[model samples]
Target: MLLKTFGWSFAVTAIGLVAAVFYGGWTGFGVVAILSILEISLSFDNAVVNAGILKKMNAFWQKIFLTVGVLIAVFGMRLVFPVVIVAISAQLNPIDAVDLALTDKDQYQQYVTDAHPAIAAFGGMFLLMIFLDFIFEDRDIKWLAWLERPLAKLGKVDMLSVCIALIVLLISSMTFAAHAHQHGGTHVDKAETVLLAGIAGLITYLAVGGLSSYFEDKLEEEEEREHEAEEQAKRSGKQQSAVLLAGKAAFFMFLYLEVLDASFSFDGVIGAFAITNDIVLMALGLGIGAMYVRSLTVYLVRQGTLDDYVYLEHGAHYAIGALAVILLVTIQYEINEVITGLVGVVLIAASFWSSVRRNKRLAEAEGSTEGSGKAEVSSGV
Candidate 1:
């Protein structure tokens, strides 16, 4: 399983590197590959969190994710998003902004940097709310009688979550609007940009996130119905067949994975400004980031590693929450992209090590139980 996962990832990486080499030679290819690996390492938690969500999606959506979804991720978010950011924040025509990016690489880099404050404010605060909501939200799974009622009640109506999001949006808008006015002066109206960005973020949160959640719930209901049908078939002494077809299953997982990938890519897409903004480099670096994220998702699923590392998901969500806070703070203060990535890596690494120790202890306990059972059997004989 490990070999297959590694082999597939290596092949994908090689393809991406080759494309980069053709576009910008060995130097460009090397840079992108390294950056991609770094992005992937920093985003392991993203894959785990995605898997938790993907498990709830329907099969058809998952297929859309693996195919068209990849296009959106590799191109839409990575290539187009930065350009869009620059165009909107700088008050330039989108075409002109993109042309500048393709033609005058240095100026384009500056534009992206100039635009980063707003991007960070919008995407950062939005992501922060997601993390905090997930963390503080009660998610207790109950099988008993009385315990299930309160746990179910806690699950409904995320009031605190809505309040936190509103606060982040208010703070982020005020700060970015002020920063934009300070830097761009007359060229860009800070208040207008901040207002637009805050609106954009709110819309994205409601549209993308709300839709994804709705679809996910619908899929879960369908899956439950199917499971019930399978149970009935079994009780009737009929042949037990696989109710969830592989293609269908793969499609749903793929779709949810793609949306999840897009959500996570918002930071890297925005952060690419810190590096050289040559459309080529942004595409290369961010593409590598996307590729690695895809590979990591597949690796996690194939390995069932999340099952072993119980706290891995928790850690990743926590890191997401931290990144969101850092992003929001950067609206007023400059937070380095490298630092953001490192914080996530450190947290995830700690969680992974914790999982490893936990598994080792479980194994030892099982071994001790088997040994005692063997001794008892011999004495009885």
Candidate 2:
């Protein structure tokens, strides 16, 4: 299994390199490889988080993720997203904008950089809201907890998030509008655009994520019902076709996995702009990152690593929270991309090492216990 996994990765990498070389020669291939490695290193936490979700998906969705999902990650997000952003912000035709990106690379970067603050602001605040919702919101719906209900009634975080985002948009628009006016540039009425962009981000998150969550819950309920039926059947000594139904059950797991993979790709694709304005480079780097992340997810699932590493999920969520903050800060502050990637890498590496040490200790304790048991048994004999 390990050999096959590595072999596949190697083959993909080779193909990417060959394509890069044919397109842009040695310089291009070298750049792609470096970017790919950097992206992969920075996204280890993404892989772990993705593994948690993929485990819940079915095999069919998993195949879709490996195939169609790759196209979305590589071309849709990396290539088309930036083009769309440029078109909207620059008031250029979409084809013209893409042509500008391909022809005037330096000018394109400047345009992207000029628009970075707003993008950062939108991404940052959006991420912050997601983190807050995930971490603080009650995961369970309890029936008989009226006394603690007041705490729950502290107002809907989602609505509050929207309000805060709107306020931020207003302030940003006024500030940028004044700045633009002072420079004799056309006043960019960014308030509506900013708010709309924020709404788009939120809607995307909810639409993709909400449906995924709903289906997952439905699948879980069905599974539980089936399990109960199976138990009752066993009690009555009745046989059932468990084998035939197993494949159908596995398909839901694939759907869950694809949804999660999409989520994990969000930050990486957005963050790639901090490295290069070239869509091709962004796609190359993030594609490699996505590939490795997919491989890592498989490894974690196969090894049952999450069961052994309790803090791994915590670390990934923490990284997501940090990334969200970083995205938000970028809206108002210029942050180095290297710093963002480094922070994620450090946190994930620390968590993984901690897991390794924990596993070693557990193994030692088990060994000692078994040795003591053998001594006691021998003495008794």
What TM-score against the true fold does each predicted structure earn? 0.71, 0.70
User: After superposition, which runs of candidate 2 have C-alpha atoms over 4 Å from their true positions?
Assistant: 14-65, 91-94, 133-196, 224-252, 308-310, 368-381
Give residue 291's lDDT in candidate 2 (0 to 100): 71
Q: Write the per-residue lDDT of candidate 1 for residues 261-295, one digit (tens) a residue.
A: 66667656544443334566667677767766666
Residue range with the least summed lDDT across 10 consecutive positions in model 2: 177-186
Candidate 2, residues 1-381, lDDT tens digits: the string is 776555666677778888778866876776666557555654565566666756665666556666776677667765677677667666678898788777887777666666655565456555555554544445343222353255346435546655655565566545542332211233444455555565666666667678678767866865786688689879999987665455555556555655665665665655554444566666666766667766776787677675666445445545566776665445434566557666656766676677778789899999999999999999999
How much is the lDDT of residue 374 in candidate 2? Answer: 100
The whole-model C-alpha lDDT of candidate 1 against the native structure comes to 0.63
